[model samples]
Target: MTRRDMILAAFVATLWGVNFVVIDWGMSGIPPLLFVAIRFVLVAALVVVVPRPAASWRTIVGVGLFMSLGQFGLLYTSMALGLQPGLAALLLQAQAVFTVVIAAGVLRERPTTAQLVGVVIATAGLGIVAAGRGGDAPVLAVCLALAAALSWAVGNVISRRAGTVSGRGPLGALSLTVWSALVVPVPALALAVVVDGPEAIATGLAAFGWRPLLSTLYTAVLCTVVGYAIFNGLLARNRSAAVVPWVLLAPVVAMISAALLLGQIPTPAEAIGGVILVVGVLVTSVRRRGRSEFSLRVSRSASRSRVSAPVAETARAAD
Candidate 1:
């Protein structure tokens, strides 16, 4: 990656990492679903004025459904139900394993041994987090977060299936954002009405102080819009193998942000497991890149030799 890309990736990571703090803050005054609804509304408004890519209504609509509606709906619900912010950040990275599974099973792609190992390690990390959290905390919320991870995995596949765009990454993102912002609010608003009640929601709105409001803005503009834009741009520049490792950095960023912002100290188990998880992801990504490079070299060499032999045969026949 270029220095610029590296910088952009870091910015994306920081934005995503800090989003846990934002979510926690915003959930204070606004109902989770309603908060999500507000975020999406702003995203829709911002992207509509931008140069978005042209795509079939089907692809655009499908991606927006999985990414915008499904992912955030489950995630916001999870947070509201008492999933800790730092840990929530870490668990969501399980999307990698979900993506790999979908790629192999649905897309008929082969999995590398390292990828297989990553799946195991990530599963282990998830197990640790699940094991660590015990209480009157709603188990449903934790399950919802897992659902969100699965939703995100499906979204990744949709983007892949959507294929390449001709300088339409930003435009495509905008279209997806608008579609997502529009389609998702219905369910979110509905859920918020049922749970928070009209009066409660009104009270929350009346009570909406600057902190929650600003935090909501940050979640919408920085984390969703800017962060996703950078991530997709990186994917456009490099293969998924190169681009996906940055996700591993998210949990670390989350842990740090949580420490600084919420003063939530990590347990020894979390700290140790986090290191292992990161190392495992790094190992898998590096080994996969090496194998890909080797395969490309072999394919190129074989093509060259095949072309050279046909020319040599033609020259000998002429002679």
Candidate 2:
């Protein structure tokens, strides 16, 4: 990647990482689903006002269904149920492994040996995180968080299938956000009505001050709009394999934010687990690179052998 692309990726990672903190902040004031729905509404409005190229409304809504509705609906429910923002951010990286698995199965893209190992190591790390949840989290909250991860994986697969249809620039995410506003809000509101009720929504709206709203706006504008725009644009320019490693950096930013802002003091096991996860990601990436080099070498050698075989046969015949 170019220096500019690297820098932009860093910026995107940091913004997305810290978004956990914003989600936590907003959760205090507003119900998670309501907050998310409102954020998407604002995002949709922003897209409508800014104006962009033509895209099939169908394609736009499809992207939105997965990215916004599927992903955030699960995410908000998870956070509301008591999953820590920091941990939620960390676990979501599981999407990378899930994507690898999905690609191999659905796209018929084989994973490198290194990636397979990375998958195992990351899986172990997740097991550790899950085991830790027994005491630290509510049973239902853990389930909700896992649900969020699954939803995100589903969305990733859908995005892989969708491939950027012409005219749906990054602003196309707004189309998804609009659909999110329409599709997700109903369920979120329904849940709120059931769990908290109409009065609860009314109270949330009335008591809702600017602080949580602003945080939601930041999530919609900076994290969703700018971050997705930059990352997706880079994905368009480069391979997903090349672009995804940059996201591993996101956990680092999430850890730092959690420690500094939330005053989360990690236990020794958690710290060790974090290191293991990082190392696993690096190991997987290196393994893939080595395999790529070996494949290229084999391909060239085969080509040379094919070219030389006929020459040798011709020479033998001449003799």
Candidate 3:
């Protein structure tokens, strides 16, 4: 990557990392599902100018269901249920491990030894996090975050299949992001109505101010759009091995941003668990020697197509 691209990658990572704090602030007065609906509605509007990809609606909607609806819905709810923003950011990285395990079962892809080890280490870290609940984190909140990660992993598999079925290596990132996002608002709004009730939703919307509005726009534009655009550009110009590792910086950024911006300090147990989880992810995603360039090419392609929050960790190379 060029110096300019390197800066762009880091900038995007910062945007994504700070996104957790933004979401927490944004959803403070708003219902979680309603806030998500509004966020995606804005995302859809912003990306309307981009030409739609040639992929089928089924493909688009499938990605939306898992990636946008399932992932964000659960994530926002988890944070609302008292998961700290910094810890939430770290826990979401478990998506990489979840993706590998899911692919092993559903796609019949065999896990590498490194991936298996990473999974075990990550699981132990998660167990520690779970044990710290009620004091460090809420048990329900942690469980919901794990479910969000699993939902993101499911989206990754659906996206990979869509790419294969379309005979395209992967759909264009912008197109996939926009079209899939269109599938989110309706169901999200419906659920919001059911869960938050019409009066509460109306009251929240009426009370919405600049803080939440800016937060929504920042997430929709910077974190989702600009972040993916820069990331896809990096992949287009360089090898995945060169570009993807930069994403490891996101958790660090998230933790620091949370501490500074939200005054969120992780407990000692949560901190130790977070380090183990990040190390496990690094182990799982590290490029092995003797792997073919063709495999790298596939990883680059997958990186471009997969849609998640910039902070949403992917397990493409592991697959």
Report model 3's TM-score to 2 decimal places.
Answer: 0.77
The TM-scores of all predictions, comma-separated, are 0.82, 0.78, 0.77
- Can you give the lDDT of residue 173 in candidate 3? 62
Q: Whose TM-score is greatest here?
A: 1
Q: Which lDDT tens digits does candidate 3 get at residues 142-230?
A: 88988998897777666655544332322376677777889999999999899889999998899799999999999888876666556
The models' CA-based lDDT, in order, is: 0.69, 0.63, 0.71
Ranked candidates (TM-score, high to low): 1, 2, 3
Give the CA lDDT, 0 to 100, for residue 177 in model 1: 51
Q: Give the best candidate by lDDT.
A: 3
Give me the runs in candidate 3 sitting further than 4 Å from their true place: 1-14, 133-136, 164-171, 228-251, 292-319
Ten residues in a row with the worst lDDT in model 3? 310-319
In terms of lDDT, the poorest run of 10 residues in model 1 is 310-319
> What's model 1's TM-score?
0.82
Off by over 4 Å in 1: 1-10, 134-137, 166-171, 236-242, 287-319
Which is better, 2 or 3, measured by TM-score? Answer: 2
